[model samples]
Target: MSYNMYLSALLMAATCCSLAISYLCWKRRELPIAISYGLGMLTGAFYTFGYAFEIVSTSLEHIRFWLRIEYMGIPFGTVLWFIMVLQYTGRQALVRKWLVATLMIVPTITFVSHHTNEWHHLFYKSMTLNYSEGFPLVTLVKGPLYKLHVYYSYSFFVVGMVLMIQMFIKEKLRMKKQVALMIIGSWGPYGFTLVYLSGVIYMPIDISPFGFIISGVFYMWGIYQFNMLRLAPLALQKVFASMQDAVIVFDLDNSLTSFNQSANRVIAGINNKWIGQPAVQVFSQYPVLLEKIKQGPFMEGKVQLAGHADEQFYNVHVSFINDKNQRPVGKMLLLSDVTDMVRSEITLLENARQLRELNTFKDKMFSVVAHDIRDPLAVLVNLMELMEEEMQTYGEDQQEIVNEMGQQIHNTFTLVESLLEWFRSQSGGMIFKPVERDLAQTIQINIRLLLVRIENKQIHIISEIPKDTFVYADKEMLDLIVRNLLSNAIKFTNFGGTIRLRADRSDHKVVVSVSDTGDGITSDQASMLLQEDYPVSSTGTAGEKGVGLGLTLCREFVHLNGGEIWFDSTPAQGSTFYFSIPTLSEASSKQSDSLRGGRA
Candidate 1:
């Protein structure tokens, strides 16, 4: 074989192998395959053209055939450019018909006139004769149209190369390793062109042949890596479906872009519709949740599903995604079913409330038991005095002292009974059962409890609580509420001041007010007057010191039984304590003698 024949054999073998590889990869739908195919066509055509030039140096005279071999790659290789990019990147709209036609036809028409005219070259116009030690050697074979063909060919090549480069750059962040493989597949044909033009020949067919070969290998490698790296969309979907919490990702429009299993269920069950729907529409259904779409994509609030049998309460933490200006775009909502937590909280609050009430009960119990015992003790002391006087003559001063002491003891008993009753009402161990009674009659009875002090102060009692009006309240509690109010009013009144009682029905509810003309309570003291267990003790006008709590117990009993008590007063003008309850049935009008708990 001659030198040219030897080179032709190697070139033919390389081209054949590349063609075979190209054929095998033709069906590959991935973007890289398209790139490899383009490289293969360019390389195979370049090598076949080189072989034609070397083996058929005698055939240049048949310009049509020579031109056919010279520019065959121009059309075939150009087709691979966009086709590979579309396949590799999966973008089908890369090249249009007019573009492919212009690239192919212009090169074909120019290269076809290769042999006839020096100035009319497509690839080569004339082959310059040269000598290589008398062996036939060709120097620069310049074609008149060669520059046009070169300019046009390179133009298509550059445009395709630039496009593939752009695609590589765009996906680099996600597939950096794979993109590197694609870069080789895309630019390999150009590498082959570089070796051919330099004439610094290296091996049988230049690197173009091997460039295509390597591209095919890389395509295989990239496919494997795509699967191994878990970038497959199918795998991604499976992972999302398995999540426990509802994970919904939204876009700038506040529309639901995607959601996980839990999120889908929540939206379907609560929102009634969530896919592509605005997040605010579903979230606002709960009363506790104040939908603040005006503020952000997400808001944290309670979900009180009005009629859901589950009665599940959730603490939803809604998140908002906004633009740079803080304008809402989309939202992600995470609902945590905190129903158990809420119930637990309510239970805790109830226990705490009950405990506070119990402490008030303890205060009232001390008031009444002390009185229940002291009342009889004072009577016994009086009987003892009567017995002593019956047995012997008593002195005038001693008798007056005995009578004054007895009176003082009676006052203490009355205050104790009031406080004891206050205690019983605060403890839920005692229930509220209002007994009906004439408002005037109950007042007269309670007044007697304060009679000794009333007489001592020379205070005039003005009973304006109507005789016809009646109050339905726990007999003992009503007595205590009114008694404490009246007792406090009278205690604060000056020696000559009058205690006025007024009871009337206002809006189906009774309003009983006790007004005293004594030095009025300080504005602050009046406000503190109704505290049930926490007492504000002050010295009365007659220098009376309290066991501290009286009205506190009264108010609790009043509240427990669906009544209200309040006080209004001006400093030095006097303070009036008002207590009201639902009027009672006539059947419940009689007082019961049951020991009611209270505090003084």
Candidate 2:
């Protein structure tokens, strides 16, 4: 065969090899790296085939036509190769649309300039047919655009090689051999091109296409022998290494496959040396953790390590690691430190216990004082009343003094009774028994109980509540709430002032209110009345003494019966205290049953 035929035959072989490898990669083109690599190989095949035809062409016109065809692939193949390397190395984020377009601009310019070289002489300044080594080859004086294309192409290849080398170095234990193959494949063609461009090796024909054939062979080996495409470098190692939680992965045989940097810090004596060892044997020192892992593939709880001087709390979570097919291929253990959270909860519980104890002590002291003073005060009131009857026989002034003493004793006794009731409620000595009761009847009963005070104050009491108005509430709590509110109104109201008791109904509940025309409380006092921490007490309009416990007890009882109490008050104007109790309905009755059942 002639020399041109021989060169053509060699280029044809390289073209056939590139096409075969491209076809194999195309079959797995679903992967981004595979698609990029396949397209690159296909472009190489096109360029090689075109060069082969150019080698045997007899005329300049035919040679130039083949060169234009070759230019189509030469400019784009290098960019594709660079993108493929990025994808393989888990740096595909760099391959943005605008960035790819920017990289392609010079290559596009070169291709267009080469096609119109005859007009502008921007790709090739001169061309000649040379018969050397028994082949007809096209020799050219490259133009400025061709030199620019060369620099751009070499830059892309160098960047790709650098990225591949980085992966090979960083991923020494895992996927190292595969990365090595890719690096070798990428470097071979680039090295050959450098030699050809530098004029270091004198040859009639450019051998870069043959170097690409060698690269394709190495790439094929990486794909078939090492499974490089399927197990391309992933970012998992970097992610796990930086994680705060300790993570350990086990294989199907329960052998420790891998662990992160945090795992080493969390578990003493654990390191890369423990990899591939049976997890149970490796963690034998912590038998609880090992046994739990052996019992089932899943376990999670707070675990305390024994070696530390201070208690170390970890939230241990173990779960099966499944493959893409949802088949369990391994198990993962995650140890998250929760010492702070556990300690906070413990502190909160202790504080709550202490608070309850303090409240109990306070309630006991109040109960004892009220119990001890009641009898003595009762005797004093009786003695004063008897003295007042006798003094009426002496003079009006002496009788008035006796009457004032009797009023003071009565006020003290009333205060003692209220304190005793408050103590019983706080100490849980009082039982809560809710039933359907007439709201109006409950108010009337409280009214009768406070009749003496009402008569003394000369306050007119009006009831706007309907006779049949019923509510679901604890009867005793309701009575206590009404009595306190009425007594407060009577004590604060001026003589001849009016006090109104009314009930309003909504879909869910009935609101009972006590509105008084009296010297109302200040805004700050109203706000502090229901707060146990800040007790509010003041003398009433008629100099009636109070300790502020009545409103506090009213709030507690209302809440116990699933009700709420609030007041609208204006200083020196009047105050209206409102409490809501569930209205008697089918829904309310059922809810009451549920609450009772839960308590029982």
Candidate 3:
């Protein structure tokens, strides 16, 4: 191949590269910047393609023909690049139709003047073939119109460079590398154009096409490394400015670097003039918020700011912004207005306090009435028992009537006692004081207390509790739990039915069970049995009535003493209620023994 053929091959290589870059940018043509950039690259492809053929052309006519083709891309390339710069630097709004048409005026004039230069001699004074450097080169004398085009191109280059430099300086730290690569890519063409104008090197071909190849390579690198086109400054700024929350950025040295418009409402007197100022000074009015920001890389808390009418609340989050290597570069403070949520929470607390006071008053009044009713019922029960004894000589009917009346009065008294206990527990009037006690003894005492009713039904009582069994629990609570379970078992058991009591030690707790061969509840009843809101009221197998308050009190006292209660039941079969409480450790048993001895 000759020297001219080699030069043509170089230009063709650049043409192919520019075409590829144009295709890449065109794929993302949805963005304004990408559209402009792709058009610029397409023009670059045309410029290089024309130069490739022009470089090898031997005839002056063919050279002039290819020069006209070169003008097809050359005049408009710089204007497209300037438009791309405007979009890339968050200035897309300035790229209006009128501004674009105004910028195109000079390039369009240059293209028209160049094509008509033969008639007017305005674009080029003269054109001739020069056989210098062993190759044919088309050389044109300087014309007034050509000089105007050069100055216009150079002006666009300077303005684009200035805009890109300003963006590089003001962009976030995370985006600096991306902007730097873009600026480097743009400089390739500008630098080569300057060298070509300065006559720094003698060559038969213009070297600006090769400069585009450099730009294409750098731009491709930026696209892959930094996602340059995908994350433009225009979109970034719009999202940042449109956020409802206040966002403030600080450097590693705790100096204010950037903030959004919403931040103005949060930080008093904050503005662009505060950039580079120490964060402590900038946030001096909000010492609590500042202290939280300086404490750690990540934190979240509530803060109150003075408002026009009432205080405003904000949920502030501080997090460190990290670099590619996971190193902390700076801190970002995000303040979200939570004034409504805070106010709602305060209102809820006040309502809850008032509700609790009303509930306490209601419980006390109910207890007072229950207590007053129980005394009269108890006195009547005692009087009926005395009357039954005194009227034993009267008749069997009279004695039976007295016994029936006494039983009715006794049931009422028992119900009143259960009501008082329930109210006391609900109102927190009952204190929980756990102590070591023998489990077997306590269970035996409750069984004996309910023995009269148990025998009336002829239900067999079985005790499987070991004599040495002991637990750590409130003495009154334990007695109540045992009494209620035994009473319920007795109440539900049929004639000659079996009621068994068992206590077994497991882990740190003792499992106690009260099972009765009585009417078993259904699955739905068992599920809702323990729920406080769904109280179970039913008649016993012996036609006895109850409100199920005993079981509820048992569950409450069990949980208060750090224990649990559950039941297993089958329809038409028997049911077993189980509860677990802490067993007395060796240390606790010894302490109880010593205390009893000291009291003695």
TM-score of each: 0.35, 0.45, 0.45
Model 3, range 1-600, lDDT digits (tens) per residue? 677688678778878878887887666543456678888878888887888898888889999998898889999999999988877665655888899999999999999999999999988999888887666887889799999999999899999999989977876676678778888888877788789879978655678777877887888788665555332221225566779999887756576656788999888888755654677888887887778778866645456654323456677788887656666666788889876676566656545654565465456446545654555576676777767676776544565556657556755666678866555544554444578899989988888888789888999999989897888987877888888888888887888999888988787689999999988888778778877432555678978866456786688668756689999887667889999998667435444443333221
- TM-score ranking, best first: 2, 3, 1
Top-lDDT candidate index: 3
Pairwise TM-score winner, candidates 1 and 3: 3
- Reference-based lDDT, each prediction: 0.57, 0.74, 0.75
Candidate with better lDDT, 1 vs 3: 3
Per-residue lDDT value at 587 in model 2: 41
Candidate 2: residue 258 lDDT (0-100): 63
What overall lDDT, based on C-alpha atoms, would model 1 receive against the true structure?
A: 0.57
Tens-place lDDT digits, model 2, residues 1-600: 676677678778888878887886766543456678888888888788998898788888899999988888888999988887776665655767898899889888987899899999978999998876565678899999999999889888877888778867866454577778878887766777788888987967777776776787787777666645232211135676688998877654566656677887667888644544677776877776787666656656567755643566788878876544565556777889876676666556545654564466467546645654555476666767777676677545565556666666765766678776655554554434568998888888889988998998889999999998988877767888999999889988999999998889876789888999987878777667766533646788878876456776687678666678988988778999998888667445554343333221
Cα lDDT tens digits, model 1, 1-600, are 356556556556556655654554453312234344636455455646554454435433453344456454644565555455444443433345676576567646653554344555445544544434232334446554666655665676676667667756764354556557666754665677667766777433334444544554555565444421211111124555576656555444344444556765555453213433445654555443435433444545455444445555655666764444554445555566666666566556545665576566666656544644555576667867775785577443456556655655755665565555655554656444557677788889989988998999999998876677766667777777777787788778888888888877886578888899978777576556665344546778877755455766677778755677777788878877777687653212211111011000
**Judged by lDDT against the true structure, how good is candidate 3?**
0.75
lDDT of 3 at 539: 74
